[model samples]
Target chain A: MKTAQKNPPAHSVHSVHKTPTNPPDILAPVREMIQACIQCGTCTGSCPNAFAMDISPRGMWRMVIMGEDESITEELFNTKTFSLCSSCYTCTLRCPRGLPLTDAIQALKRIQTRHYPEKAKKNIHFYASFLESVRRHGRVRETEFMTLFFLSMKNPFLPFSFAPLAIRLMAKGKVKPGFPSAGNGALDPIFQKARELEASS
Target chain B: MKNFTHRYFYYPGCSLEGTAKEYDISTRSLMAALEIELTDIPDWNCCGASAAAAQGELLSLALPALNLAKAEAAAQASKSTAAWDILSPCSACYLNLKRAEAETARNPALRARVNAVLAEKDLQYKGGVQSRHLLDVLAKDIGASRVGHAVTNPLSGLQVAPYYGCQCLRPYAVFDDPEIPGTMNPLIRAAGAHVFPWNLSARCCGAAHMNTHPEVGISLVTDILKAAKGADLLVTVCPMCQINLEAYQNRASRLAEEDLHISVLYLPQLLGLAAGIAEEKLGLALNLAAEKDFRFETINEPI
Candidate 1:
């Protein structure tokens, strides 16, 4: 039922937090966005997986505004709803307050993957595997990517479930399971710098 | 300025090469027919797709910024034309590149941050090049009449639903009204196909959510296909939408208990078919469900 924040109020009814005495450069935008939230529950209600989400979007926004850092981090790790966002931008579009819900959730996801790699392994594994391929070849080598992706999983046999589909695809020549040549040299240094920034940040 | 008249740099993102090979073939074939030469962004990197930004902010901007730098260099190097337009066929790539351009243009702070990271490459994203979706180029630059004029075999009876997956329409209102984009309707009609009113044309087919949460993605795809129930097939721009709808239909059917047999076709392939290109040349035979569900036996005949 394509729903929207029918009539958002002036401010979130949830109590505001006073814990943010100081904010980092990265979190500054998050803080500004936190104030912009209307607590309309539209994001949570509109979320395709709200029932499955451990921390509803409304609850997550409330925690962010309250500066309940520890609780928010725990919720992110335990519920993994931030990881479930498909970047559909439905919440961002529907937000009467115009909060960038997708980016905020992904920012939390970055924090989650950074702090709890073990818990966020599934969420970040493909990302790691994909970047690894891109780093080496500039372009994504699907063959190399698949090998890295499946092997990274504790149970490698899981990929076999999609074998029937893969075979049909191979027959149709949709898949060329081989390492292709890397792309040009333009982005190599930028990628290295990004890696360095990620480590430092 | 993307007044793409004769030629422009094209970024055929990774999915086009792998999962959507038919899209690649059809795109190349159709571009040839249209006399549009797409210089591949030499050695283009992954546009830091749905994955990169989730991990690191700097990585997200820098990845696409590098490609823009390359396209800029190409445009500057060409003395004949000042056209510095980068056309990305994949919706994710198009959105990411456009986001990079807009982000750099809108927020000087973010632009400075991204440029600081790019300094090592002697690169700076000055944000002059125009980014456009391929459909926009075909619609605006190539013009509908020219496209219609090239059509030799009109698909007069084929009932089609144009699917515009999420990434292309969201976050920005670039080419068409995101809500009711008539971008593909004109092209489909030019090819002589029956355009059905598909309500889910702008819906998301769960995107990469299919990877993390298969059930969620499958259910979304089910809804999209179920919405396009009366149509014989669905035509889309994104490789993800096409692959997801075509490959995962049966799973969604089992889960939703509906006969979701709509074969997914790339817009280029349909245009190629209507332009009288052989099915083999345009890679229609490679479409996972097109052969099984589509009634194109007569249309597949080589002109």
Candidate 2:
């Protein structure tokens, strides 16, 4: 009888080392956790936004598992599948293999923002504008955050899309007028420290 | 009054401060009515929600860690030995803080890395703070019996569909069955209201997509409103769900080609009404749906 394969090829195709041209190292942990995925359609089925996604959640995982080649990894990042994930966690809860699929999706987002910034400019700007607001006020000042996002989009007509809702929210006193006052800056230290750590890493 | 003095450290999050101000007001009013003491976590910052996750995991974990650390510091300053229960009314905030707490507790290396970032601000999280959703505290800490006892004006004829949006239930089934959550049923019944049966209780409201991708968000909201056509009011625990369900009814109606105009109110807002708390204190006037669709006198006058 063949001996039990205790540790058959520890670093298989799935365990490719981090490289500039390869998949991001940040996703390695989540990828490892989901290595047991059986190509099941549970995640894709459970995802509420999968209907609108360019690639299904199951297909995203398939790319991650078989993503040893740089081209496959590039294709994974190029798809808008992970961007549409609303962090609903439905897929994570319903996965038969109990994989951290939601986290894996999030890792894809982070990778896109960091590695493929040119492709993810719109989303990157949106999130950056949001974080800039949080960094400044410790809490998001909605109007200012929206202004920054609209400005960063470089599309003057984009604000018109939200004009109806903005008017309604303002009418209800949900959107306060006037510039947001400076916050206590209590979060400055933490934000500064986070930036430093990210830079070093 | 029965001795049910459950104390918690409250984190109302950014939405409660702005768009969902009613949720903040009603949560406080309802908690006070129940004789629950809530100490605000001093200098609590934003939980970063889904936006920060796009930046990096460190920043995502760090933002929530800052709030958790602040809660821990406040707990220590009070010289309390008991484990801290940090209650957040926003589902997104609750999940962010809970995710950080759980991740830090499970992984020592990651904890060290986060602690290193926090140490610059003279803060450190020892995983002492237990982050909880308001629904968890309501269903688990304060039982339905106590809630029922506090109801002075029972919402007898009110048909409420309890909508438990994504974050509070999923990725952590601490208080109720994640997939088929029934925690709010007892609370609705306790308020003397009929629980409207629906399968979309735990549906995704498309969250921030309401802004980023309105079409997709409106489509999801349309499905939910279509399912909840018969209900008088859809009660929600998360501010995100409340806004998404309430703010987009007009567009959702147009999309579905039906008048899916159900009044959306926070769970605490409904509970506060049943408890005889004044509408002003509950900020019921602030609710967009309540302003148009809900009738306060219907529930106020005894059936």
Candidate 3:
């Protein structure tokens, strides 16, 4: 019996309560939800992008709970972290507290990027490349987005890498080289609107 | 005083004005027949769509906020004795306007900045008006009971996967379930069609991704269509999703090496079809339909 004494029954260590210092003016709906969170970890368990997030959804909200606004704000646009959220609402539905976690994250991201202009420019290359395709053709042709994305990234071998798959898909009538098909001639005004918005922005 | 049959502000935004002309046409026609009235927001700009939001969050909100403030002011200018609500046909427009409205209601600091930008346009948001997507308006305002009464033609054999897409149910669950939504399903069934249980119904249509990463987008789309297998069509409430899923299906299907190409129809178009409206009137010809393996023209219509 003495030889089998299991190391004092292994003491349980509780985690610290880290709350976020959020701005007072954030949406009341989101604020109420964030405040009511009991750190149940249910949200963390349900988040599809949990592994992708630097501060997982639950972790981000925990920061929000402790009033760590800046930390969560920084996490929001850290595209690799929050941008891929998919807004699937898995975390929202699973939370026993009924926290509007998805909406709260959306509010935070909007507030940060709206107040700070340069932060939004980070995804310029991706969007600009895509828009350039739309601007050239009336609509967004898949072949164009691919070519532009690779070109912008300067990955010369990208198209070649996709060639085998493209050819295979093309043989199956899956790859429509000339997309947009100039359907009913509706692409012109779409381009005009794009240009206007671009100029105004 | 009497309750009006139909009255709401209409914000078509950029897409319906151009690429999604059918969405605009059908919305106008259906609203008219339903006795619902829509007030157009004059000189409305794009709701920042995939481009601006992807650029910066502030600009994203600001752009759409400009349009919202304009709508609010238009409502203020209206002498009508009813509540002013802005109805958006395009899903992107609906999401953008709704996102800005939700954020402005939440963040006073951000609201102040939006106001600073609005000052340039001399417009302001008093938060009196609400922005809603067409599906939301249908499920809530129109009521499924009313829709059920209007089904002149029932689609007995049409198995529809009610695809809500990302913008309609996501970034905010304004008027529908975010996960496993049923707003359109009830309406679809009421219009006399079968609602297929599709897991990817609310998934992203790879919106801007189709233009940013074709391979990645094709995969995203293939996953959605695959989950929606056994459906005659993938019905959507978003113009962007409709365009992405329908216009790019052949390409996406080819890459998938599976017969994942499914016809994508707008909800209004489906309803119009069920209402005994012709294809040209419902904007059917506007869609990029895959060559169907079978036709059901002779199938008995339900009522």
Leading candidate by DockQ: 2
For model 3, how does the per-residue alpha-carbon lDDT over B111-220 read when each residue is reduced to its tens digit? 87677666655677767777888998889988777767667888877788888876677657778777778888788888887888767777766665554445556667
TM-score of 2: 0.92
Docking class of 1: acceptable
lDDT for residue B34 in candidate 3, whole number 0-100: 64
CA-lDDT, candidates in order: 0.78, 0.86, 0.66
By TM-score: ranked, best first: 2, 1, 3
DockQ of each: 0.41, 0.52, 0.10
Model 3, residue B266: displacement in angstroms? 0.3
Model 1: how large is the Cα RMSD against the reference? 6.5
Error of 3 at B80 (Å): 0.9
Model 3: CA > 4 A from native: A1-122, A128-201, B251-256, B290-303
Best by lDDT: 2
Model 3 chain A weakest 10-residue run by lDDT: A10-19
Global local distance difference test of model 3 = 0.66
Q: Indicate whether candidate 1 or candidate 2 has the larger lDDT.
A: 2
lDDT of 2 at B267: 94
Per-prediction TM-score: 0.88, 0.92, 0.68
What TM-score, to 2 decimals, does candidate 1 have? 0.88
